[model samples]
Target: MESEQALESEAEQGERLGWWHHSHPTFAGITGFFAGMLFVTALPGAFAGLLRLLLDYETAEKLFPFVLLALALPIAMLVKRKTRRFAQFMFVGMVVTALVVLGVASLVLYFMVDA
Candidate 1:
């Protein structure tokens, strides 16, 4: 009986530490939103690279954002741990900035290549 109680307590402790806990109320929302934004922003570059390597546009498009999301999720989690509530705003800002920079760079690169 004691061992069972101990095990249950340990499980609760683990739950408290997880991102979904009340203490980290914003963690999931922020992480998910940022991860999505990051994935979408990087999708074009990832797709292009994958397409170049595999010459399979369909596969590349499908896998590109999954890979990007995998990469972005950890980063967002790290930020959430470090900065808590501010992490959400920071993540959103960072994603927007990245998208803007990527968009501008791609346009420039396209023009340069065309010229």
Candidate 2:
């Protein structure tokens, strides 16, 4: 029985429900990086470790990463819907983290080869 204006206001309120809605974009991006680091990376790593402990180590090392990836999607979807533009920010964070790690690893390898 809500009017059109009531529905519009409800939509607006829904959009504004989360704390990140009014914050700066850079802060949101940082929030996403921390979120992705803890939620996406660290969490999965812990799960993999537990799986390795519970199951065969080599099999868990190989399979649990994909299992974590599959499990993370639902949680990420919930986060994306709840936060503003968070999925984009989180993906950026993940990619940047990956690139930085790869760069450091390659540099280490190059230095080792040089020495």
Candidate 3:
């Protein structure tokens, strides 16, 4: 038993594992979920900000539709076997986050208008 343990440790030391390999089982899910949230929230804001910085308001608004192109990256990830699981979690996170944000925004608007 001790000899086997020693061999296992030696083998582990011989090859370095990548960050993904060394991470916890839930790491991928958590990371993917947060990535999706950021995708929905920050990515658009950052894209819009970049556009506004480089172009006039009219041009920026016109080009806003192009942000949809980013969806292709997640679709590609879903098609790949290795990343499919992460992509699935990311999709769920995106939907949930969007729903929550929209719900809260509507509630705030309703109350503000009523009061």
- For model 1, how does the per-residue alpha-carbon lDDT over 1-112 read when each residue is reduced to its tens digit? 9999999999998887773645666665676566556555675666678676986777766665555455555466556565444446546656786788899999999999
Clashes within 3 Å, all models in order: 0, 0, 0
How far does residue 113 in candidate 2 sit from its true spot (Å)?
A: 1.0
Model 1 segments more than 4 A misplaced: 19-23, 56-99, 102-115
**Estimated TM-score for each candidate:** 0.41, 0.61, 0.82
Order the candidates by lDDT, highest first. Answer: 3, 2, 1
Best by lDDT: 3
Ranking by TM-score: 3, 2, 1
CA lDDT, every model vs. true structure:
0.66, 0.71, 0.90
Query: Which digits, one per residue and each the tens of the lDDT, describe model 2 over residues 1-115?
Result: 5698899998898778854656556776777777665665687778888888888978887776575465456356646565646666666677787788789999999999999
Q: Model 3 lDDT vs. the true structure? A: 0.90
lDDT winner between 2 and 3, please give it: 3
Positional deviation of residue 73's Cα in model 2 after best superposition, in angstroms? 2.2
Can you tell me which runs of candidate 3 are displaced by over 4 Å? 1-23
Worst ten-residue run, lDDT, model 2? Answer: 67-76
Scored against the true structure, residue 114 in model 3 reaches a CA lDDT of 100
Ranking 1 against 3 by TM-score, winner: 3
Model 3 over residues 32-94: C-alpha lDDT tens digits? Answer: 899999999999999999999999999999999999999998889999998887898899889
